[model samples]
Target: MPFRKFLGWFKGFFGKKKIIRLGLYGPPNAGKTTLANKISMDWTGEPVGKVSEVPHETREVQKKEKVTVKVGGKTIVMNLLDMPGISTKIDFEEFLQYGFSAEDAKQRAKEATKGVIEAIKWLENVDTALVIMDSTRDPYTQVNITIIGNLEARNIPIIIVANKIDLPESNTKWIEEAFPQHPVINVSGLTGSNVNDLYSAIAKYSK
Candidate 1:
């Protein structure tokens, strides 16, 4: 069957809505872009955004459409927005490793500061947010808490994605325990693990 038809059938089987919106948000290098790429590929069969090892690779919000997902026996069309990661401080050290001269690094550092501010400003416009976090790192960063607190203050639904679950040092349980009130899902973007559950959770609350 055609992929769209298959998606439609799948959606019909699940009883999901016809349209949904999701915003992917997280700190730098926490797999926000990775998860976004995975979801875009799974639903549309193509990548909608760029993936990079460097922090702040996505400086702007990249959106991809034609996402056909099944929830509660119905097909729902999703418009996924992949946003730039947030950080309290710019990483000039990593920027220098990208082969940029000291002058260029300094310039980019300033640009990164603007980018972080832009990302925080953009959060207010999103309907729902998926806060991605690296499972191997501590989730106690100020940026993480600020994003969560702002989202909660605005009453926007949120899903905390603990990515890189396949990594040996991943500690998703700790994240869940730390943010007991927020919904948390363990996933591996590289291996496409536990993605369906994440999608399902987002779909459930979004509707």
Candidate 2:
């Protein structure tokens, strides 16, 4: 079946009058913020989250509500939560790029320790999660696997968003093969490509 058609049928079968709680999560620079912004813009018709090129730009979780998504002929209400990027260690590279001294970078990394833990804690409460990944790169990071495994352990449904598929090096098939157990959708946040398919997929799991 065509990917989009499969998603549509999945949504129609499971997405009905459900108040979906979705958590957007990924490693640094994986386009988590971009995906969040696109979903917010598409459903709310406004920017509900910020988009930045730097890693860990979102320090706190941003919540938006009343996101109306039409899936399978039903308009489902969605509560979107945009979370800080999860990283095993403080992004020293990003910190140093900002002109921080080694000592200062170390200190900031220590401070960011709490943020990582908080982000993980937030995941436990979410009903569903979107694991964003950069399609241009191999999806073999420990952080990504940990997040996905934890959610799976808890029986929380997940959808992997292979963001940045429009990039020259993006490879969706490799990602699909890498994570054979989960569903993955190739998306381009910059141009809003495959955004509806993502919404429909999430709506399907929301049921």
Best candidate (score: lDDT): 1
How far is 54's C-alpha from truth in model 1 (Å)? 1.4
- TM-score of decoy 1: 0.86
C-alpha local distance difference test of each model: 0.83, 0.81
lDDT of 1 at 4: 59
Using all chains and alpha carbons, the TM-scores for the candidates as numbered come to 0.86, 0.84
Q: How many backbone clashes does candidate 1 have?
A: 11
Cα lDDT of model 2 by residue, 1-207, tens digit = 979447757776885444567888888788877777788887777775667665676777878886888887857787888878898666666689877798877776765676677789997788789999999888987988999999999888989999997889889987898899999988998888988898778777764
Q: Write the per-residue lDDT of candidate 1 for residues 161-185, one digit (tens) a residue.
A: 9999999999999899879998898
Report the Cα lDDT for candidate 1. 0.83
C-alpha lDDT of residue 56 in model 1: 78
RMSD (CA, angstroms), candidate 1 = 6.8
The ten-residue window of minimal lDDT in model 1 covers 12-21
